[model samples]
Target: MNTVTRPRILVVGAGFAGVECVRRLERKLSPDEADVTLVTPFAYQLYLPLLPQVASGVLTPQSIAVSLRRSKKYRTRIIPGGAIGVDLKSKVCVIRTITDQIVDEPYDYIVLAPGSITRTFDIPGLTDHAFGMKTLAEAAYIRDHVIAQLDLADASQDPVERASRLQFVVVGGGYAGTETAACLQRLTHAAVKRYPRLDPSLIKWHLIDIAPKLMPELGEKLGSSAQEILRRRGIEISLGTSIAKAGPEEVTFTDGRVIPTRTLIWTAGVVASPLIATLGAETVKGRLAVAPEMNLPGEDGVFALGDSAAVPDLAKGDGAMCPPTAQHALRQGRHVADNVIASLRAQTMKPYVHKDLGLVVDLGGTDAVSKPLGIELRGLPAQAVARGYHWSALRTNVAKTRVMTNWLLNAVAGDDFVRTGFQARKAARLKDFEYTDAYLTPEQVRARVEGARAPE
Candidate 1:
């Protein structure tokens, strides 16, 4: 008689991918059959779709963050840390805990849904002059920074200083960048009413990117309509342009135009986390290459998904790959979990195949755009659909209720726009939150090993 060891599944990164993976695994697997664990830096899974709302004061910071412990009902243990490296051959992962300790955890099966990090360019002074909009910290920083800018503009004696303090530049024209600009501009408009000394006209917002059109992925017609609404609301949309240089008090664009501004938001794009490349697996554009089943090819009991994995879009012909978005990530996570359980049972695993469901872009206030099921929508009705869709998409009741309450309060009483006073006056640069350079590669690791042996 052979005694079967309980199958152990370890999910890394608690973003859409990791969280959904564990959620599905718990639902499918019997307690006696498998043991599941999730590793994440935080106890909550942040609803990234509403990050722009949080930055713009439409929602509070906690509204978008759902507690993972409260949401998960299964026996899965949550490890509070980040997976820094993986030893695929040994089936061990090196994780860095929040307390700055390194530990190794072994697993029978590993789900590499580590997600992506911000991809910054090599623009002059960008690392030192720009702010990021990727994480909770960055979003909170932007909120306080915007309010502080208004306060500074009100107090400045020199017109140039005041103008610089009031001018805001948002780089990137994707949904994230556009929504952030729209929401922040609304906050400024609402908050400046309190500062009688400040002129709302002095507050200028410029959205710049090298893309010929804003959100071309959203199809042409809806994209144009969304851009028009933003333009009508006093937003300067500079297409086919990018920042040439950034300074403490000015931003120089590729069009040979320079604007004096202290606020520079960088939201250009994202790449897979450096941890993926460390696994010594095939990678596409920094993302781990995985099969349609979300399993890494040639690797046993290993899988990846979300922004960190290059998942093929089997639904689309011509060998196309899915774009990194929350919608796809959430679905991919559930599919991967099912596959993991199938593997344990020695059953057939299913491939991840889901058609693109449409996208929604909230432009703050009663202005928005959406394309659900190939139908294009815009204006107020679209805004309602967008908010409703996102509110329903939230994972937890507490999160849903909090977000709805914030939206209702804002609608009734308007935004407070008061700076949280956290991370204020502390100028944040692009490099402060994200690292642009590639981390230690195999060659570098080899050299480090050789040096350590030779010297000490």
Candidate 2:
């Protein structure tokens, strides 16, 4: 008797797109149909939007981290590693595990949704002296660092040191930077009362962006409102400006102004993961280019989506690619899963299409701005919409409960402002978290895959 081998489906990333795709595939595909494998550095799908709250001590790190192994029905093999390279010709991916072990994984069907990393420019000292808000570790480290700064400021006798320690700089006026600045400002503002020696007036938050407007996607009126709200809270909003150079003690702005500070949070933007380059495929603005159905044009059984893929914006048309947002990524993930199943069954695949559901900006406490379903809202109403949307989007009941409990606890009991001290002696930088140089070259990927298959 002859036995048939099952088709292997490999998904790279455990982010919004990858997790959604895997879940959908697992639910739809029969056990005998295919073997599904997930490649990821961590075991959780991080709820990235709430990372600011995590950094501000409003929510615990585990609350936003939705575990991947929670599904009892899941049969997918989870590889505790990151895909560093993909050899499209050989249908193999080169992965670097958490223990620094290298392995080559082959697949018949591949979904490239490895997401993105912090995008940095040619600016000097950026990789060395900046803090990022992308990952859970980064958020936790930032919280500890921020609290330590306050502790140092309170204990110091030198006025200059105190002043520098009190000042914080955040670049990028988009959702991440804006929310980070707002939430952390609130943390410091509330915590300063405990430190009677430190003057509240000395705590300054400078929010600068190279773009002319703050959160330009929020439109003029809403953007103006956000800017006004932040400015009212004493946050110095500087438009059309960015950091020219970063130092251990100060940062020099592009507009030729130098500010003394220890904290420099860089949330400017993100670029496609370095893994995308290994395939040597066509890309639009560093993102892997895919068809309307989320598949590579000539590559059989190969798909790409989320931040790594330049998926066409069918809703907006006019040759526009979808913006790298959680909304689009989540939808694209589900849509691509359907396409993958369709291909397997030799059925017609549908193109990905979805209208915008509007945007939400949580500025900590009751301050928020949201345009849910095109209905503009602000203050308490906006805050309600923002939190409601986030709570509903959580994948698990446990995640929702934890997040809700955290919100209630924070509102009633408030924060303790204690430093975890995990990142005390370590220097956390852009290069540290985002190992951009860890990816293998296309030639190296091909060699590794072929070498593994060769007889010893």
The parts of candidate 2 lying over 4 Å away from their true place are none
Winner by lDDT: 2
Model 2: which residue pairs collide? none
Q: Tens-digit lDDT track for model 2 on 90-192?
A: 8998999999999889899999999999999998999899999899999999999999999999999999999999999999999999999999999999999
Query: What lDDT does each candidate get?
Result: 0.87, 0.94
TM-score of 1: 0.94
- For candidate 1, write residues 82-125 as lDDT tens digits: 87777776677777778877677789999998788877778889
RMSD of 2: 0.9
Best by TM-score: 2
In terms of lDDT, model 2 sits at 0.94
